[model samples]
Target: MEVELKLLLSPADNDKLLQHPLIAAHARAPVRTQQLSARYFDTPDLHLLRHGAGLRVRKIDGTWMQTMKAGGSVQSGLHRRNEWEGPVDRPWPRLGKLRKLIGDQQQWLDVLAADDLKARLEPLFVVAVERHTWDLDVDGNHIELVLDHGHIERHGRHVPINEVELELKDGDPASLFAFALRLQEQVPLRLSNTNKAERGYMLCRQTGTVPCRAQGLQLAPDATAADARLAILNNCLQHIQRNETAVIEGDDAETLHQMRVGVRRLRSALKLFEAAAPCPPALLEDIVWLGTELGAARDWDVLLASTLAHIQATPGGRSGVLDLQALALKAAHAKRSEAAQALLSQRYTRLLLTMGCWMQQPAPEGLEEPAQDFANRIMKRLHKKLLKRAQRMDESEPASIHRTRIAAKRARYALEFFHSLYGGKALRTYLKTLSSTQEQLGSHNDLVVADRLLRELNQQHDAAAATIQFARGYLQALQTSRTPDLGAIRAALHALRLP
Candidate 1:
């Protein structure tokens, strides 16, 4: 692969007016440069190739350009960049020809746009050099880097975060470290050595919200459909495991959210494969335990953050915002850090070990049922349990919504686990309803917890009760809104055709 250097500069750098502290100290710029290129290959179904490392995969359909790369390793935590190109109708047989067709293009760049129009953060940008690229799984996620240069195109995403450059190309560590130090002192910034993906994986795993993937393990039936299905399952498991670890370690909040996603994916996968590959009851119990624990932390975190943001955005709320925010921050950090550590302690280790052992055990046989028939049986059984749980909810009980929310989750998970076999428009429709139910309940639950935590924090910090009064009011309003949503959910649940 041919080599080139890359740098991420602030928009203010348009006049080359920016100065890094390290660069100023050294009388030189800390800007990074490297040589890199790649090419890609993939099946029509996007079966083998997906998105690049630490980047989100938008969908699974049509042609996805595989990436390959060879370049100077950068010192930063950045890994060599990989990419999954946009959708194409080209089939597997024509991949080489298609790649050759695009080989001579001059540039390639993908910019993830700002996530929100009015958000505080700047947009994120990712630039790539296209060359000989092959899409393959590395450590679970789809990876594509330079093989040979065909053409390079820069795609941009409008997101909330501003110019953050990840020197994914191989380069010098000293150079990267020097760059980081320079950036930190020169500007108000959150400098991260860890890429988004790794941190996210760790958070999920530590919190028990996601199942961790066991390394050095391989599934049988390599040539069969089971191999593909199993691979996805394991990927989800490992992602959750890593995310959980991150949470316990007090890594970034985004990591925790990603981990939650892994949990949901795994739960969904289990539901999808319920008939084709059923897990044991004991194993299911452990997975459920992991979900509840992680979900507790995740739910609270989201609720507090959102509510805090909501307050800050308002005029009256902003008047006493700093004081209230400081107290909220203190409480949030305490709960988050404490929860994280609790999940990673020896007790949690025992839980993980136990779950690992269970995964190693054999699952019940599929009883020779047709793949679809088997899948349906699993779905109906699981869905029935969800309905049973939902039925247990009582309007008189204070925690009734919370209990039913858990049921909604299980129902959604049941559908996800069986997606490979039972996945269809109908199943999707049912899951959509159940998912909305869970979200409504979850939002209410988050407000409750946030309110209590905010109040406690206020008392600890000697803040007046009136300052934190909004939290209580918010929680009550949330409850009232959810009451109707919950009813709608129950009605929709009855409309689902689980069988």
Candidate 2:
């Protein structure tokens, strides 16, 4: 996730802005209030959310203060300064003040609106601070409290995290640097320049993923390896069952998508591990079937987005471009619907039962699986080799990087497959970088795949042909631009000592 450091200054504090180096224009004017909401999302363990909402008042002095806000926060919610403004001192007693207004069981809802702003606020910097947040219900409507103190404590797949945000909810970008400079001294805790939402997402995406059974055991003994492998496979299957339950219950798209990705990765890891310790042919077959069905929809969603993006970006010159693009999009949606339907079928349940029964049997004696430390070591070794291979392939033959990336991804998955057992801050950090790099390469690869599909569309018009050519060129250019400095990224990955 990205972090940021924020300094908020309201209209009342506008004159204070004159103390700063950046407030030359607004020496007499006050910062205006504009409506804004920032939400933070996370699980109890802080694995999923560390987000918030803010209605900021910005001054020319580079300070921006948060005001009463509305809307849903990702993990944190409804933290506005007006609520915190009483006779309270710095780091106001938020929970105490909040509880006095509304009890723990009732949730509060407020609609805040303001309109008076100029400035795109683009090319902005995110100022953040580490802070702990509680996801409990305050007065029933889910309320998260973000304290002034930046605190993070890792437990299982969650953590205690916080943030300090800085931005003019009214869309002004001036005074950011100057405000940051001032806040650096007033705030007692270490200031962070990261976006909590981005940081939390990266943390969740990289860390806190449940592990597979294969990750828990060493592939040393034939019998023990077999038992451990099956155990991991069952665990992976159980992960699927858990996620499937959420999907069946109509979980949000993001959560469901996360679960779906887990299912696919676990299934893939199990298949690879099972190569050494073969599972029942029938059991393996069932797992593959589920993965394929789910993967089809997921893959289609990814492809469709790219295709639509391409067509949308095209100029007004191409004839029949709309028709071909429509056909491709329709095909993708159809595939997604079909896959979703298949996942909800009775056969999926039967497969789930079969897999569950397999996981229930007791462990064989002296199984003595591989240690977590050892497995992590192997994963890192594989990651380093694969990364080098990816860079090497980038220069010589990009085609080969595809396979090399898959190998690195597999290793990363193998490690993350047991995200529950060895999850922590460092591991989370590595996984975050790994996943980001993987995504960039993966997106590049997706464009390559999409190009192949477009080339196969068999369009005939000269205009259509030209459009296709332009689209392919656009994709190629995008791919080139996305390929970042892999060496430095790799170094950063290495810096994170994975366990």
Query: Please, what are the lDDT tens digits per residue for candidate 1 over residues 1-499?
Result: 2122122233453222233333334332233333332122222222222223222222122333333322222211233443334343332222333245345432322112222311322212222322222232222322222222112221332111123442323433234334433343444332222333322333323333333432332333222335434554656666665565467654466667766676666667666666656756765776676666666566556755786676577565536666776666665576577657655544444333343333434444543444455446656776786677666666556487787776677666545544555546886788788878877777667666777666666677565577677656755665665554545566777778863
- Top lDDT model: 1
Name the regions of candidate 2 deviating beyond 4 angstroms.
Answer: 1-235, 242-256, 268-277, 314-322, 344-347, 364-366, 370-374, 377-381, 384-388, 395-398, 417-425, 456-470, 484-496
Cα lDDT, all candidates: 0.47, 0.45
List model 2 lDDT by residue over 173-247, tens digit each: 222223333333433222222333444444445643232222232232333333445545644544454455334
RMSD of 1: 15.6
lDDT of 1: 0.47
Give candidate 1 misplaced runs (Cα > 4 Å): 1-235, 242-251, 261-296, 335-354, 362-371, 388-396
